[model samples]
Target: MQQRAAITLALASLLAIGLSGCGASEAVETSPTSTSGQGSTTYPLTIDNCGTQTVVTAPPQRVVSLDQDSTEILLSLGLADHLVGTASWTDPVLDSLAAANSGVPRLSDNAPSYEVVLGTDPDFVTASFGRHFAQGGVASRERFAETGIGSYLSPTDCDNGISINGGGTRTHALTIDALYEEITELGAIFDVPDRAATLIDGLKTRAAAATEGVDFAGATVAFWFADTKTPYMAGGLSAAGLLAKTVDLDNVFSSSPEDWPATTWEAVADRDPHVLVLGDLQRDRFPGDRLDDKISFLESDPLTQTIDAVRNKRYIVLHGAELNPSIRFVDGLEKIQSWLREHKDEL
Candidate 1:
């Protein structure tokens, strides 16, 4: 707790120094339009983000995205040209964004050192998870602020008690609203509100279409992110929970508050989920990070082989990014919905 307080104090001090002479910039009133005639974002735009006041003097020209989700969000906004560096990928880039992502320099497949990140000379930085800003990951948001670099952390991770060693817990269930807010805020920061709006609308429309008439009232499911021995199961307040709730599927481990809680195979078998949603991560950080490994373990293990999901091979594979709160979360929802449609009769 003392460490956390010190970090907070440092952040406040740095923010104060950064904003020493800057009073609130004039607010520009414009119609909330998503296209032309939408007035440009006024300079010295100040955003109260995750309890930190982020001041953007101008649209970030050289930005460093510290996570895959944030990188994808920027790419979707047509701001790929503004990206100076990107890092921490869990899966392959989305097919549609591959061309643009290929152009951005990859700092690392995981978190890059603070100095390495600074070497890119980025005017702004962004991350989808709070862990990336923790001490051991890259650098604290305060550190970036001290260097005159504006930063944004996804609202989904805000106040979630995240640390370098854990994924954190969520007291309330996550929805697409947080993700939408991130996109909209990033748009405002980049002076591309229209792109953000269009992206949000499209996502909402897709989510609506996916959930239309879809009801799986009593069906039970489990999301396994990684770790073969003590599987990390999704709790109720995560992106996985959002997908389950969207289609009315009950998450077997929904009672847990931790975003990803490690559970014994015996415990998982006790619930005996009707379906298993496995994360197909490209990163090999853990034993079960790969799809084949997860499947092989489920089918071969004595404790899990008898489980209903394993017995029936009712498995749904999702990219690692899809399991996290981001634009691809909508993709995960659609895929799960599609799977249910195909197997509803079995249920």
Candidate 2:
């Protein structure tokens, strides 16, 4: 499963406040903002840090997006007018995400420096990558405040500072509920509470629809990512777990102690799942001839042929974005719905 720490507006009940400094409440606005729309509720949003509140009279006008996924959400919400810039630490914008990305200032070739962030005169800086904070000096919470720029961490990237056994790190330790929570939070923060509620409700409905009549007590599957020479395993509480629940399939990797831990082929052989979710392949990572040389390696891996998922062809190849938990998460549920329907006969 994919996760983000790109600090897209974070929405958690923080146990310990980060470096966000305090801003005294402004003299009360004689007339508080009316947040209602046709009987809908309006909340007086207080963007705070450590018990203090910062209210904006209108929607943000100068937003600097630090993570691509967060940028995607802003675009999805039709909030590009607020964008002053966008940046990413990983690959550049995929074609689907390019329309919104064009012409916007690039903060960095790979994560623009805080000075660059300041230069944009951004009102809001979106990012939650732990490295941005945990490994300080690059762009600490202090930097955002010093520049009068508000910083938002991705609430989904909750791994705050937790470490995993494998090489890679995981986020907020992962939970389906967390995914829904993030969407709802984004909705409220962006003043599109209705859309957030609608999207989340649709996901729950679709996931339930996919698993309605099936049983999975006897079946064991792998939330498999057969890429990068090793088998990446997804733990329960991850997007894959949510995916498994959607289809009433058991993910053999459900027992992983850490979320999204790297499991070896030997481990896969030991559990030998009946199904495989294999999207994050090398071919998928590269669009054209960029990574073609590794095609033979992927095909020749011993795990390729011996896994039951391969022989029985119970593999599920998902779109790259599907693996991540975001508003796009609903898109993932849709894909799963279609895939399960296409293979419902097997179940």
Candidate 3:
């Protein structure tokens, strides 16, 4: 209770630093997803993913995606026809992925066994996290290559030269740029560069429009990814961090190096964020984790009840699909920006 009270006090002390002159009225612009979009891409394209250099001799006809983010990406690129099998994370919110996956063979609810994945006869596979390709995981890149299967991992999970599991030690911050790059790369690999370019353009336009009138510079934001004894926070380098920054909010956990850090209630109390951004995950996995439950925690807790944002009922919710690195990143940004617009007075 004392911890919650301290959080409320800290937030009360910071409320006077109002967010003014923080929003950029002019459309904030970013470079195109990739530089290779200028000219036609030649076949047999080889690119380094994670730590492996994969050469695509031709467009893969049968694909198996090991994660929701990868499956959603394939769906967004109109590659549903190419997907022969999939192993999705539980209860992904993307409508198109769900619809496209209806007829697709379920390799597994989570990561499928090596023999099971191989049984799907997939020519290509993609996973959002590098851990999927690690030892004792779905399968290693070498094993896939031995079977003439190509694999790709989302850049967000890759490090540089230093190997961690099946990924590198490169700690590139997950941002819209990375999302665009993934889309563009997949398009080129699938022989649909034009489609990828069009999709990226549309995404950028929507993102720009979402921020038109919203200034978020000084707003302290906290992303509660889970409801455990210790809260899970989105690190400054992850996709959630990028979303927070997109709206110009100062992420309380932005300084943490880990992509998702587990910290105590005292830490959250210290930050006393102005707005709480909750990442809504699947109910099956987190039965008691709901937006209402979190809100209740804030409203009922003696210490937390005094927090300015909680006292005033300022909260924003983002689905897991929207919070992860994938085609829906722009959509997530737009949603949060819209929410902030609705609660502009709180800022």
lDDT by residue (tens digit), candidate 1, 69-131: 999888887777788999999999988788878899999999888999999998889988888
Taking the tens digit of each residue's C-alpha lDDT, what string does model 3 give over 1-347?
A: 00000110111212122221111111112233333333345545666665577777667778899987777666766677788888856445365345655777778777789899888888888888777788768888778888888888776565563333353433666657666667667777776665566666667677778778777867898888776567777878777888877778888999875666788767887788898887666654553256667776778777767666676777888776666776666667777877876888767
Worst 10 residues of 1 by lDDT: 18-27
Instruction: Show the lowest summed lDDT stretch of 10 residues, model 3.
Output: 1-10
* Most accurate candidate by lDDT: 1
lDDT ranking of the models? 1, 3, 2
Candidate 3, which segments miss by more than 4 Å at Cα?
Answer: 1-41, 90-93, 96-98, 161-172, 286-289, 300-307
Models, CA RMSD each: 8.4, 9.6, 12.8
lDDT by residue (1-347, candidate 2, tens digit) is 01112222234442111222111111111122223322222333444422223443334568887766577666544456668988753334545446656767777645677777778777766653444544443475555565565555565555543312212355433666755655455555556544545545555665555455555445677765445555467787666666676567787877664556666778877787876665443234332212232234434677656767656766566644456555455555666666666775674
RMSD of 3: 12.8
Full-model lDDT for every candidate:
0.78, 0.54, 0.68
Global lDDT of model 3? 0.68
In candidate 2 the C-alpha lDDT for residue 312 amounts to 71
